[model samples]
Target chain A: NAGVTQTPKFRILKIGQSMTLQCAQDMNHNYMYWYRQDPGMGLKLIYYSVGAGITDKGEVPNGYNVSRSTTEDFPLRLELAAPSQTSVYFCASSYLATFTDTQYFGPGTRLTVL
Target chain B: GQQVMQIPQYQHVQEGEDFTTYCNSSTTLSNIQWYKQRPGGHPVFLIQLVKSGEVKKQKRLTFQFGEAKKNSSLHITATQTTDVGTYFCAGPIKGSGNTGKLIFGQGTTLQVKP
Candidate 1:
């Protein structure tokens, strides 16, 4: 199982540019999430999906969007990249919402917006 | 939004020394999980604590959940160079409109000098 995979391990974008960060999991998880980690900061959730066709905003949803059309994929969209959007982004997925539910993360994509 | 904080932003210890990090939340949590991220890597699940005052051990690492479920701790015994990384504590925030999203702490970075 490839676990979770993310594309574009590294990316550099100019202000106002747009891009889609792709995430996919072979574990067939029911939940998926997108989080950004700034240097020395915690993982700030940008968006998440409970299941196919169900998406919601998280703690830090501004400047980002997400879609969950299948059980194996959850992609994050950066509408207009800004300097503040520069950070390492991670994608994670879990089997279910149980007490023992543990999320599996991807290698993460490093983005730098100038 | 629920917030989690981890102390000792950074900790440096010589090989074979002990190290510990604490995570505190502003509100009660249903469950807490610990993850480790190696330098330039993504977060990986270590363990999850559900019961209050629960403690679990994994080889050289010990994880504990507070009696109130609002805090957690990770202690490493005789740290090694391979233990050098950032440790994070996360939980499914409980409050108005829960999204089953995990709120992560501002991880504690550990530097083990061999």
Candidate 2:
């Protein structure tokens, strides 16, 4: 089964451009998270959703937005991309809110802003 | 904001050598989780530690949580090429009601040389 799927494995955008990174999970997990990873750095949380229609900002939420319209989908939108936003973005989903179950991650989407 | 710190930003070990990475948090955590990301891959859940002074093993890897619940460690008995990757420790911050949000450490990069 495809646990988590992220579309557009790689993309390049010019400064001030906008794009949405798509993420979907088939496990019907209640918790979903968006994170970015810079070279040689740990993953930084950008946003998270506890369930459908319930979203919250995370540690690094600047220059990004997220929407959880359905339990199977949580997409990240970059309104105006900046050079600093260039990084590998990851989408993860967990079975419950306790985080006791493991988070399954997608392959990742590499975005580069110039 | 709560911070998780990981030591030895990078490590190089020869085959058959032992390796360890330490993670410390500024505040107590309900639970701690470990993940490993291979070169050019997304992070994958490895294990989780819950109880104080708890230790768990997966094959040659051993995971430990401090008695205070503010620190953790991952030790690999013998290094191999398959173990070459970045290891990250993550835990939810005590305050701010970040129930499902995890703060990740800077991560420790392990390079196993044959």
Candidate 3:
């Protein structure tokens, strides 16, 4: 069912470059999230959207922006790529108000900034 | 912002041995979810524990939620080679309808030696 799908499985960017990471899900979930995982570190929330047109910043939202124009798609934009921003990004989605349904995560995109 | 802490950042267990990981959240959570990520792979939903002192089991994996709703644990009865990976515990942050925002622990990396 392609629970959660992300684009650009891997990417290499130069300093100051900008790119968008695309995430989509077919589960018709109302909650979507963006997270990044670094070497030996736990996943850090970047942003989240409860529903279409509603977005909020999470733990580490700096240097990134997110938009939820449609319930099926939530894209993450990196304004300025830097070495510190190099990490694997993941997208996840879950049903609203259903505490029992666990989140489904995407395959993740590996980004390397030089 | 709430903080989630997981103990024993890294663990190596021989095959057929038992394994356990503990998680604690700074604030009370409505529910706690567990996820597993294999090397070079994405995180997959394992299980969710809700209600004080709740416990759930999936084969040899057992999950527990503390009575205070601020801590949880995952125990594997007998480790196997297939159990090698990083395990993460996540709890939703406090404040109005925070079910969509999750704070993940640092995660415990489990390596099973066969």
Who wins the DockQ comparison? 1
Worst 10 residues of 2 chain A by lDDT: A95-104
| TM-scores for the candidates | 0.96, 0.97, 0.96
Better of 2 and 3 by DockQ: 3
Model 2, position B45: C-alpha lDDT score: 92
Candidate 3 per-residue C-alpha lDDT over B7-77 given as tens digits, one digit per residue, 9 for 90 to 100: 98999999999999999998988999999999999999898888999999999999999999999999999
DockQ score for candidate 1: 0.72
Per-residue C-alpha lDDT of model 1 across residues B1-114, encoded as one tens digit per residue: 567999999999999999999999999988999999999999999999999999999999999999999999999999999999999999886752435578899999999889
Please tell me which model should have the higher TM-score, number 2 or number 3. 2
- Per-residue alpha-carbon lDDT of candidate 2 for residues A38-110, written as tens digits (9 for 90 to 100): 9988989899998999998888999999999999999999999999999999999988767476788999999
Clash count (model 2, backbone only): 0
State each candidate's clash count.
0, 0, 0
Q: Candidates' lDDT values, in order?
A: 0.92, 0.92, 0.92
lDDT tens digits, residues A1-114, model 3? 879999999999999999999999999999999999999889998999989999998889999999999999999999988899999999999887566667899999999999
Residues B1-114 of candidate 2 have per-residue lDDT tens digits of 688999989999999999999999999888999999999998999999999999999999999999999999999998899999999999975663634778889899999999
DockQ, all candidates in order: 0.72, 0.69, 0.70
